[model samples]
Target: MYKYDEIDQTLVDERVAQFRGQVTRRLSGALSEDEFKPLRLQNGLYLQLHAYMLRVAVPYGVLSSRQLRGLSQIACKYDRGRGHFTTRQNIQFNWIKLEEAADALADLAKVQMHAIQTSGNTIRNTTTDQFAGAAHDEIEDPRLWCEIIRQWSTFHPEFSFLPRKFKIAVTGSPNDRAAVRVHDIGLRMHKNAAGEVGFEVIVGGGLGRTPFIGKTIRDFLPKQDLLSYLEAILRVYNEFGRRDNLYKARIKILVHEIGIETMREKVEAEWLTSRDGALKLPQAAIDQIAAHFAPPAFEALPGGIAREYAEAFRTDFEFGLWARRNTAKHKQPGYSIVTVSLKKEGAAPGDASAEQMAAVADIADRYSFGEVRVTHEQNLVLPHVRQADLPAVYAALKAYDLATPNVGLVSDIIACPGLDYCALANARSIPVAQQIALRFRNWERAHDIGELKIKISGCINACGHHHVGHIGILGVDKNGEEFYQLTLGGSADENAALGDILGPALNATDAVDAIDTLVETYLRIRQAGERFLDTYRRTGLAPFKEAVYAAA
Candidate 1:
């Protein structure tokens, strides 16, 4: 985890002080709601349907036990008693009072965290794989680059107010867990023919009204020129991206309209001018940042499954199931990555109570070197848990309802707050997700289904990343009634592709049943060892569509 320096501390403190005054003015009638809108948004505060929502950034999804404790305190003291972890790996408090917003931020600053650039057209949190430092197959830890980008873009005057919000994601592993291809700028780390690692810079990828799997603008970008290349892309978008229509404002829209070839030409022209400038990262500077993220000290433990882990797997059937679904291989010997599933049956996805958060903090401190990670899938992670302690970690997590062994299963659905919380939402998403998750409560059936990512969004904003889900559901407003439109064959991996929609929007109840029907159809027709996504890609939408609509 990267700790804040003097500069980082000062900037966060100043922002807190600045926003505190802004809030005071708004309360004093010196600033009206409309006047304070942008000011508050710049500080990551939003006025939702019923209350104010505060989004706190968790850069690259890394958090210390101390920081987690700070967030837990803020959740309990300032807002509601829970925090919602977002798809971007940030956390949100749904019920914040305007007067207390500043105090909450002040508290966050004490822990070297803040909500800066979390909203309002700025480069929002630069995310990466949750297992960045710990993944065994990583070419290099992407968090090192993510942090560099964060330092460069924090207050860059040129990109402070782009035509629309921007997002960037990085993945160092061949298996893209960060969903890099669905970002405005996706940087994939891989080795070249010379056996040197560099980034594959993909541009114009995004999800919303118009979803796209970003095009590869540069096949291999050297690590040294990262900042210069990013500057070129932003400059091109800032100058040429639409400002006339809000709907057409994103860089993706500009790429769609002008074509990626032209977009590339403009960016390349811009890069030529900036490549050798101060923005070019030198080896010394890179090393300075890299030093901050060096791997944690590890004991000289032997490799392979620990004796305790094997014994538990043999004797405890429930433990065996949980271990298989929730744990992942780590880079270090005898250590495993534990994903704490937030999507328990019938509960809202990605939400954790203050108590639950504190419990995780304690668990991390005791067994995982006090470090935790928030995943893009909206789950918490104990990134360095020893394999010997798997049972203990499972027991601790199970006590708080966090041990829902469904990491990539049907019940582990990703969904936005939807009509339940978001003001822009036209239909309810939480209830729909809950209903669908409940239908897949059978552990045998869910495990059998295998690696189905069901993402739901209240609207086309794609906050829940519906466009990249294996089975995507989008809520729609139809004559004041809530309905859902389904899309299948979508995935957010290395071979990322936008989902194809199944015909027609179904009412909420019908939509839930349709998912069951779709799964049943896949199970019936799929060849041996085929997952839902594999079956969909093999058979296309015809079979699943026929099964769903025919049942309706």
Candidate 2:
């Protein structure tokens, strides 16, 4: 919850005015579609299959009640009565008109939010763990560094347009909730052997047409040299990254072409020149940035289980299940992190209706210190909820249909807006996701099957993060017919790995059955207390692939 300063407000307002004029000229035929493409993209507007789509950035996935209300208003007034939360922890309006794009951005600026850098080839939103400040296991609040990088990267002259789009993620926890390993650059904060805080810098990690688990370039970098090191990495990529082919233009491909050892040498050479330059952060500045992310006022209470929470769990079986699945331990006594699931049965994943947004905003204000967080898994988090308020929060969410208990289960899927909205997509991902969700609607059965991640992408672009799911589903068009390809053992956690292809692509109609077969195979072969991923890792792909293809 960093409040915008005067400089931040002024820059956003100016950008809105500039884009408004640009939009006017484009509508008046002063600029053609080809000429206007970059301008619109710079403002986070895309021409999709049906209409214009506008993406709004939620920095580090953090939002205040006021910002959530602003998004709800935009969804109610300008576009449809809903908005789609993305895998990158941003929100998208799929039915925006070209004329209203600037107006939407203007409204966003009023709430200290903007759509800038949500798209295009510049540094996109700098994301981090949604539970950054509240998580008990964190070494430091990663959002402090995320905000520093956000200001440094915005409109930087040298990196405004690179070889391809870049993404950066930071994690303060050892558990890696932010999916740091799959980003263009991943920063993990930890203490060194001497007990001094520093970063483990990983670069060249990404997933698209090609997937890679980023290699660590710097084992331990001093905290003060973050910007200098990042500048060096970007400089190397800007100069040497491929630009001729869009498919091979990402920094991941560049790192692949040159070995990690050579890439590290080049970055180290570049870093020597910029280490003490203007980008080198002073301790005072770091302290100033850290002040903005200080912990909220918390009351001291008993650390053990609360009486009300225990009673609710005993009385209500459904609430007990949801509490166990969707809540995480909070660092402060009597507080918990409550995940509000958007993956209700038969609905589009990560989508929230206008009314639901308003309801969530209200709940956040009343029970979670007026703050909400969007997770990379397409869920919302009330990071500071009191244990005593659990029942009330659950009841309110139930009224809004936001209390699904499937946080990491099979039905809690991740999907992109496929052919339904995206022009680049060849097949419809939403329908495929919906079919699978419906097939797994039995909550008890899904819970019994244990933790599983099912991610679906409309194409190879991997917007859905299909490559990192425990069960990855990619939609492909073969000879004008839609087919679905499956991959297994992919994970985006502390043990990050790319899923291997299970077998040949199966027809769209048979995709759900194939998933069932895979799940059944896992259940039969899994050892005691082993999760889907653990079983897959132990048993390998032979069992799951054999079952899926046999059913096919």
User: Tens-digit lDDT track for model 2 on 1-552?
Assistant: 788999999999999999999999999999999999999999999999999999999999999999999999999988999999998899999999898889999999999999998888999999999898999999989998999999999999899999999999999999999999999999999999999989999999999888999999999999999999999999999999999999999999989999899999999999999899998899999999999988888888888888889999999999998999999999999999999999999999999999999999999999999999999989999999999889889999999999999999998999999999999997889988988999999988999997999999999999999999999999999998889899999999989999999889888788888998999899899999999999999989998887877767
lDDT of each: 0.94, 0.94
Cα RMSD (angstroms) for every candidate in the order listed = 0.8, 0.7
- Summed backbone clashes in each candidate are 0, 0
- In model 2, where do residues sit more than 4 Å from their true spots? none
lDDT of 1 by residue, 269-370 (tens): 999999999999999999999998888887779997899999999999889999999999999999999999999999999999999999999999999999
Give the runs in model 1 whose Cα sits over 4 Å from its true position.
none
Q: Per-candidate TM vs. native? A: 0.99, 0.99
Candidate 2: pairs in clash: none
**What TM-score should be assigned to candidate 1?**
0.99
